[model samples]
Target: MARPIWTGVLSFGLVSIPVGLYTATSAHTLRFHQLQRGTSDRIRNRRVNERTGEEVELDDIVKGFDAGDAYVLVEPDELDEIAPGRSKALEINGFVDLDAIDPIFFDRTYYLGPKSKDYAKVYALLERALAKSNRAGVATFVMRGREYLVALKSEEGILTLHTLHWADEIRDPREEVPDLPGSRVSAGAKEMRMAEQLIDTLAMDWDPEEFHDTYRDKVADLIKAKQAGETVEKAEPAAEATNVIDLTEALRASVERARAKGKQSKGKQSKGEQSKGEERKQRTGEQSRQGKGGKQGRTGRRQGRKESGLSELTKAELYERASAAGIPGRSGMKRDELIKALEQAGRQAA
Candidate 1:
């Protein structure tokens, strides 16, 4: 594991846990260095005095803030003299519901772990406490000479920390966005239903692996091809942004496309299963599996029933299936309602 960047004690009331903070993510972006065209020489940057047109040493640098007509220069030592006292520690202000913090306030995430083996127990205790209460500790700490507000909460078995933006940093959208909609435009009930259906057809669980930095990949490919002395050209159709002519028609088309994609996916999976079964049958003549065939057949029958539509299952069976599928509000759902909800969730999961 990489060494943590920050180490300190996490304080909650009278309890404290020795902890270390490690960055949770890294950039895989391509980097470039400046070079003159047709030359291999590199270009480097230098700090220069604009008035004197001379290079300045790092030690001579000082930060200045523009104050109307004149600039107010501040020395590094002077700035450090008044730095916040909480720079070396993370003291919890209080715990709040995780949902209470808006997503817009979140900036970056870090993983928190015990600094030593002896601290592991205390760390686990804090993790479980926050998780059970569905709360996160808001705290302040300094890193890289800058103070940050952060949330410390449990994710799975480990503690995760998220840096937050100050409230003043968030801008009001009403002031920035022009002619914001306040029911100026509306959709009919039929149109709304179609749109809802389209959304349901496309609804899916989160899977980060499905996304890629395609443009960056293309740039990397270009770099490689250039080094290998090759020319490449590719074209992809542009995507349509909006269709204002017929909202209902667009929603209907979108629903059909999503459903078609789902069908195609299932069709491919079915083909794969059939192919595997055929290969097994060809190799064994459907007889090498007879040792526990009776038990296997009974189990397969039970599995088949479980996989069947919700309508074919009893109330108890429906409840069990709903629970297994992680459906919300299942306890209050009637048999028919459970059947409909489970069917939709099953399709989405597939």
Candidate 2:
């Protein structure tokens, strides 16, 4: 089981509920580490003094403020004293309507659950009350020695806390965007009606699971293929941007494309749902007929191999094939290291 990173009491009105905070999301992207090119040695960073051309130790480092043209160095302990909080507690100052809070303020989200069995009832009560009132508890908390504005809302019968950005952090759009001089109004009622129709036809319920990071998937596939000792080919350059002249014609074409895409998506979704249902029925039927004996033992392995086979093969394939020949974590290796590893593995196999 995943453990909560933080343990604290959530304060609102006269009530305080002890809760544990768990991260609600995580990144799944591949990471790379720096290394020396020729020796396959991991590279290490150093804090260096620019003037002396020498590495500085951690203890020598101090917080500095620019006073005119001079740097005023402050001790670590002194710096900590001036920081937002020595004690980390979410001090909720006021309650606000969830809708009233601007979407721009939200930063990161955390799941807040009862820290102990005793707090469960109060937690549930707070969640239900927030749900019924359509209000979120506004709170202040200190994290990493800094004060943060947080919104506490009920999500699926559990309290979820979201860290908010300060008002000053949000940039004013008006500053960057120019005010239009009321000259670009050429769409007639018929065009407006057609646009609205197109929008309505393409609209669907928001399903987050339906969307994915396509770029991340492609990167993963590329990385995997490169690991397996394959030569990576250069991708085609992107199409150049073109200037549009006829707005009406463009709008018409866009509407047709949107409709076509919507229909295709709907058809795919229906087919997928049907396939899942059929699979479930087949599993049930097999269970009834052969008492678990009909189940395939290597189905998962076979499926994995099939998926790996069909995925795009890249230069990463060489690294992976090298790794299989006793190279470790070729995924973290550089292109040159991968090439060397692949060559060594090939020679050994020969």
Candidate 3:
């Protein structure tokens, strides 16, 4: 079992609840070490004094504050004397509406669990109260000699602590972005109706699991192949974005494509359900046409069948189709390039 990184009492008003801070996130990407190219020696970094050109020992290192043109070296003992006691306490100042805090302000999250047996009731009470009120507690805590602003919120009956960025840390967008007064667009009545219909056809409940990190997965697969000493094929270059000159035509095509996709998804789901039912029926020794053997036979034929729409067409063929459909940048497309453009166009249409 993993242990809590910090332990402290969570205080708000007259209420005090002992809590433990546990990390809520971790990095999964594989890490590599630096080494000498020719030799099998591992490379390491060193802290060297610029003036003396000598290496400095870790014990001799001291924290320094640059004030104007001079560096004021702070002694280790002096820092320890003024340091806040290693208290893991989260002292909540006040409660704030969840929407009041911008998503950008959130840095890292941690699970705040009850530290002691006596604190369980109070911790549960606080968690339930925050859930009921839909408010997050703004708290301050000192960790590793640095003070941090934290937002304490309830998640699935458990309390969660999220570190927040300071106000000054968020840059002003106006300073970096240019103003474009004429870029604002007003949708036409017909366009608005078609757009709404498309949205309604594609609307579904939010499921985060439906999406995967395709790029990361592909990278991992490449690494695995390389490790196994397999020759990796070079990936084709991506197709450039198509320029659609006719907005009305593009919008109409997009709506039609979305409706088609919705129908296709429904059909696939129904077929899958039917297949499952058939599998269950075959278990009872019923010699039905919808048996496992029949399903496997159909799957075998489907596997051999070529894709009629985009899959069957070569890159050059796709490019020509896209060009004929009035897509821009079709003149400079190679076979691979055309395939991507056509796929994108088809997606936009569906």
Candidate that would win on lDDT: 1
Residue by residue across 1-350, what tens digits does model 3's lDDT show? Answer: 66998888899999988778899988755566799999889988899998998999989999999998999998867754674553456788999999999999999999999877877899999999999999999988777667789899999989999999998889887786677334475667987898788788778877443333545545666788998998666778996554645667877888889988778766755654454334333323332232455676555323322222445765444553564445676654545566566545544543
Per-model TM-score, in order, reads 0.74, 0.69, 0.71
Model 1: how far residue 36 lies from native, Å: 2.9
Q: Over all chains combined, what TM-score does candidate 1 have?
A: 0.74
Task: List model 2 lDDT by residue over 89-154, tens digit each.
Answer: 566787798999989899999999888899888888989999999999887776655677889998
lDDT of 1 at 309: 38
* Candidate 1 ranges with C-alpha deviation above 4 Å: 276-350
Pitting candidate 1 against candidate 2, the one with the higher TM-score is 1
Off by over 4 Å in 2: 36-39, 57-60, 79-86, 178-186, 229-244, 264-350
- Against the reference, the lDDT scores of all candidates come to 0.77, 0.69, 0.72
**Each candidate: how many clashes?**
0, 15, 4
What CA RMSD would you report for each candidate?
A: 12.4, 11.0, 11.2
lDDT of 1 by residue, 1-350 (tens): 78999888888889888788999998867899999999999999989999998999999998899999999998877765676456658999999999999999999999999989998888889999999999999998887768899999899999999999999999999998999877768868998898888888989888443344656657776887999999667858897777777777788888998999899767755654454334333323323333335876555433433444345767656675566556787765656777777656644644
Candidate 3 — which pairs collide? Answer: 257-349, 257-350, 258-350, 315-335
